[model samples]
Target: MAIDITLIHWIYISFILAVIGFMLFRRDTTIVCVVGILTLAATSTLSVSASITSLFNSFIFAITELLPTILVISIIVAMSKILTKSGINEVMVAPFSKIIKTPTTAFWTIGLLMMVISFFFWPSPAVALIGAVLLPVALRAGLPALGIAVAMNLFGHGIALSGDYIIQAAPKITADAAGIPVLDVVNASIPLVITMGLVTTITAYIILMRDLKKNKTYTSTSTCSSSPIEETQEGLMSERMKKILAISIPIIFVLDVVVMFTLNLQGGDATALIGGTALLILVVTTCFAHKKRGLEETTGYLIEGFQFGFKVFGPVIPIAAFFYLGDAGFYSIVGDYLPENSEGIVNDLGVALANGVPLTKEVGVITLTGVGVITGLDGSGFSGISLAGSIAQLFSTAIGASTATLTALGQVTAIWVGGGTLVPWALIPAAAICGVDPFELARKNLLPVSIGLVITTIVAMFLV
Candidate 1:
């Protein structure tokens, strides 16, 4: 059957094209989302009166859903700010500096710390913490600021945030679309993630090596100007603050890890656990910051936290709203759709391709991987995983490829692109925190990431 594109399809395609056009010409996430939403409304025949309303409603809904998580992240960030002001953040990483003497070790240490913290806390918060503390160490150890940016970008945001095994954001999207268990998707994502990490990290190491050699031959060093490091004044509970933070942060986080293992709360539950712990830490930190005015201070910190959250996620809201429209669950929010249609443009596309394209298991896996990488060009890794999961569904048939392999490949490619490597915009947090150029970071990651992606694809062919 010839694929019949409907009004919904046209709306979606127009939105995507508008985003693409904006990216090419504008490169602003906010503008791209606004243009995309407007185009979608126009294509859907929404009334002028309803267009803005729909957009606002959609935006509000998306934000509300994400607000709790963002709030938790904000609290953590606020606590990190408090920690920074107290000079404890610097103190925390002081030990690591002594242990990691060389530039290479410093780079990897920061990268590894980023990866670990990001896996539990997330990339944004991890970036702030690591950048505030460890970045100086790396730079002082002779690592280029750009190099630190790349390491954090790849290991933390790109790999850890993209996979999000502990957080479950990525898996939840994929699992819901595929109608499979989240744990299954998590399991499937592991080998592909490991392979991609090895490929990308090794390639990144080689690039770092070359850069190091170049630095060796040059006496002129482009020293990064010192980033403003804020130190909070000691509150009434200064002594207690020191003890609590030193003991509390690690203890709670460690408990979270232990709980995750004991209960097998692998995905969303794990994220919730970590977020919950961060909230507790936030309250404790604020209490220390204010003492008698703890309540007021906590509120103040919460507001600051929300402001930071909004700053980081405000641009993402509309973008996610536009992408949310592509999902069946939110298609109605975008506009009324034709009857008999399920949600998401990518899912529809996947179904059409699955039914029409005749292929073997290997080809099916490769095709799914390509679909993931293509959809990921939008630079929101989670946006495309639904399509990946839909593709995974096709390959899960009796005669199809292994669903696990298909899912893993889809995750690896989607994340690699949207998480950091290909898109300059996606590297904003790490790049900004490191005080480096986002475009340069993206460019540096390209070759290493591409080689890793290819190697991962080949590895998936055999393993999956």
Candidate 2:
């Protein structure tokens, strides 16, 4: 009845702690992750050459496993580039812009639009997508740049990314580690995300309103002396064509969703459908926008997108590879070295804890939330959540709790903390776009986000 905990298990856990410590200290974990893999490999194979080969193989495996996520992100970025260049983004947001008459309207309008766009294009690009065009208008309408930054950060990077329902990247990673279906995590996260989003955004808006009432002279940050908007350049596409693409593009993506539901597609199949749609959009948009040199321009846009994708994902891969060793990567990257009757290293640990300790759902909920916040200190939100997922699986099994709820809790906490709201560095894109100091944005977000996390964690206890 006892599960055997192997040396590999200890190594995996030890390296995980080291990775967390590094993240807490705000150090890069790539080296720590690589060394962890090599140590696991060397322990398993006991041969220097094979161990090194295993290390290389582990990287290959990580890349292979993450390729679909990478591909979809790259393709989406490619599509966004074409959309931005062709001025179609302006067309897309025109109707929404007309409704922003005051600071209240500005906050809700920009925040909601950012959340929607972020679901599809992701927050980093979505910040650029809506920020530049709307920043000056919001500033003129009396919303401070800091308020704008907070809205985008909380709505787009915090709310949209935490749920990640459309793209499913966050859910996919956490679900993989929790050893559950992606839909399970997504389904469980809906309520928690809504709660966190509502609590955080409303709290921030109220605090911001009070701050404004007290300091009616409160104005945009110093950097807002000039607009972030670029001068409009004449493009290859006509205004009529831009407007057409703007209307048609959303319809195409909407149809992708309809088709997904109709065909019962999910997971990788769903992601593939979305990726294919983005790729087609990129090609067609580039072709229409570039006209004669459409072929070359399309390639050029894709290359840029790939570059951005890899740059963003590069730090994530090594860390992800290390966590993969806890479960699926154990046999392939190391060896069939798990003890007999052992489910996996992480699972074994969970079993051992369950047998030895009196764990409860409350303990599990708090632990996952704590781990999520600690891991999020690194500011690269995605880099640390693999650890969250692994830990969620470990804790949930021990507590006899729902892995999906625990995993979703961890996923949301990590993203809210590091995905651009609480972390200064992660908040830079939105901050810079709105001409506010990143630290100020993070400061403004601290209270609201902390409160949200507390409430969300309490809600998660019941869910678990």
Q: Indicate which candidate wins on lDDT.
A: 2
True-structure RMSD, every candidate: 5.8, 7.7
Q: Across residues 96-128, which tens digit of lDDT does each residue of candidate 1 receive?
A: 678677877977888888899788766765665
TM-score versus the correct structure, for each prediction: 0.72, 0.64
Over 4 Å off, model 1? 1-3, 14-26, 101-103, 113-153, 156-191, 205-229, 232-244, 263-269, 279-283, 286-298, 355-363, 374-404, 415-450, 459-464
Clashes by residue pair, model 2: none
lDDT of 2: 0.75
Inter-residue clash pairs, candidate 1: 85-231, 85-232, 326-344, 328-343, 328-344
What is candidate 2's TM-score against the reference? Answer: 0.64
Q: Rate the local accuracy (lDDT) of all candidates.
A: 0.68, 0.75
For residues 61-85, what per-residue lDDT tens digits would candidate 2 score against the true structure? 7778767656766666667667766
Model 2 regions more than 4 Å off? 99-232, 359-464
